[model samples]
Target: MTLTSQLTVGVAAFDRYLAICHPHKYALVITRSTSNIMCILPWILPTYVILGPMLGWRNWYPGIPCSFDIIFPKSLRATAYIIVYIVSIITAILYLPVLKTAWRYYQRMNKYQQNQTRDHMQTTNKMKKAILGAKVTGIVTIAFSIFWLPYMTLSSWIMVSPTAKSKLESDLANWLVFFGASNSIVNPIIYAWKRPDVNQQFKKVFCGSKPVSHVEHIKT
Candidate 1:
């Protein structure tokens, strides 16, 4: 589930990159059917990876109770880690150009805002919102990396040195696994913090009162 969330985030960043960097091409290429496929791909891909061993495609360690522990053979586990890290790296790389383009657009908009008409101002505001959306995704990506890296690194170490596993090490790995899973909880909070509509809705639900003032909506 965590991996699926991460993959979905990558898909979102790709969508924003297309919309902001290559608007004309994006308009031509991204249709309703294409959007639905993109939404489903993340879930399907991760499910297949997670279920491969259970489905008898890969060997699992016998006599080990199913948990977060390394249950797969060393080679298969290593291959899975390699693929995950490579995809994560590529996703991070893709965000770089998207953020750069957003920042450049922001600066350009700010420079011209003083002389712009109402319609242009609206366009400028839309660009500012897009930039904010990009920043939110960047922050989420950073959070995901921070939360998951310790477990990934420790797991890689264990894979390299099977004999190094001990009670203390096992406890630490379990803690890190829980910590990584907490990223899913943090994700919604991050979105709520950055998005005014979500924030207002949260307030209404939890506080049972209208907000004192309307917060400008920041689309994410």
Candidate 2:
């Protein structure tokens, strides 16, 4: 779940990169086929490469029930952390051009809009949309780290330590797992709310109202 949720943020970051850094090529590069593959790989790789092998471990401690939700053994936990770190690093790298472009747009847009022409108005609006999308991506990244990092740290600690901790500590770890799982639900809401163009669609879907603007929906 953590990997899949983070990949959505990377998807958005990549789209923002195309839009901001290479606007002319976005439509050509992000075609129907490519987009489908981008969406599919995340769900497939994590479940198969990470979760699949973990489930197939042969050296389970005797007498432990063979259930899916067990506390991961040391090797499995380390593997999971490695996958998480790789995903996080790649996502962070994708954000670089996005943030830099947004900063550049902001600097240019601030010069003078008092005597704006139609072309200037259009450019400014596009820049604003880009900036908003970048901000939403930043928020998603921060939220993912907040919810998942501590849970992973504590889980690794539990695996390493020889003795069992107190009931309170165990309960805290369980709650952290729930918190990390909630990122999947929270992420869509973040994308919808933060982007002005998307917020209109959000309202229309849940509120049963007319769409507010003809603004193109920001890709997530």
Candidate 3:
């Protein structure tokens, strides 16, 4: 859930970025009128893809409320598992380009920081901040992949390999779940830890005055 929630927020951040940075284009790309709809569709679509049929299968039976097991009938379980795998794969695939673009920008911007003449300082500073946000988005995306991939892989392998019943499986699942939970915490953590602009903007919103420096906020 932490992973999913983090992902949701990250997507929201991208949408918000477009709204702030490219307000008119947002409507052309996805539309301001349907922003909430667009935001939620990603989060909820997975359930319908993965569990909606599982729920229907339960209706045909008696006590089975939820599961991705063989007892649910071969065809149904197979379909559900495939749905899960496909969704997980698609999620990973979808994020790859985002990570790549973010990484390149991050590297370029980090390198650009070595020089800042007064004449081009403002322009470079703005570009650097833009790149930093992309870098943060990439990190958040990678963290999400790291935390969730194991769970998804295990799920995919559960039927083929029965080795998942070991105590180590429980431990791995426990830790993964914890990491997933960290996703929600990360939005704030990234803001305070890695993103000075976001933190300063937040401060201005709540503290009633502008902060002096990005480095100062980061120093804490």
Candidate 4:
């Protein structure tokens, strides 16, 4: 799940990067097959590299039950470390470019506005979409990092701790897990909120009628 979340958000960030930094090439670079493959890697790595070995070695370890919960202590510790660091690194790599791209685009747009550049309306519209994509990417990146970092940190600590976790610690861990899980639920809401067209279509489907005219369309 950690890998999947990071991968998905990373792709979203890359999409923003292409839209901002290489607008003309964005459509060509992010084709349907490319996106599908990016989506598939998270599932593939977890299944083959993580779970596959666990399944194969399930019988080798006798005392620890052959279940997902019954991981070897060392393996759990390593997994904990992997999740924490890998996610953080991948997120940084993904978002840093996005931040740079957004900043550069913003500066260009400001300069254009001040200079009264040609094709003002068209340029502004494109800038708005690029900026909007950057904002959405930023939201997803922040949400995932904030939600998962604490949980992963606490989980790693727990995995390495010699003593058992107290009731408070256990409760806190459980709550953090829920907080991490909530990001999945929150992401779709964020996307729909950012894109008015999506929200309007969603409303129409449920209402079985056209959306109200007063609903403000997102400029992007």
Error of 4 at 118 (Å): 7.7
Candidate 2 displacement at residue 189 in angstroms: 4.0
lDDT of 1 by residue, 56-79 (tens): 664557886665444456776676
Give the alpha-carbon lDDT of every model. 0.75, 0.74, 0.57, 0.72
Give the alpha carbon lDDT tens digit for every residue of 1-220 in model 2.
Answer: 7767777667777877787888889889999998998888778856764655467644458898663335445566677677777778877887787778777766765677577899978876776676666778889988999989989888778767788666786888879989999887888888667766566766788997777663455332
The runs of at least 3 residues in candidate 1 whose Cα sits more than 4 Å from the true structure, single-residue gaps closed, are 52-70, 162-164, 200-215
TM-score of each: 0.80, 0.76, 0.53, 0.73
Candidate 4 clashing pairs?
A: none
TM-score of candidate 4 relative to the true fold = 0.73
Clashes of 4: 0
Better of 2 and 4 by lDDT: 2
lDDT, model 1: 0.75
Q: Model 4 off-target regions past 4 Å?
A: 46-77, 80-84, 114-120, 164-168, 208-216
Collision count for each candidate, in order:
0, 0, 1, 0
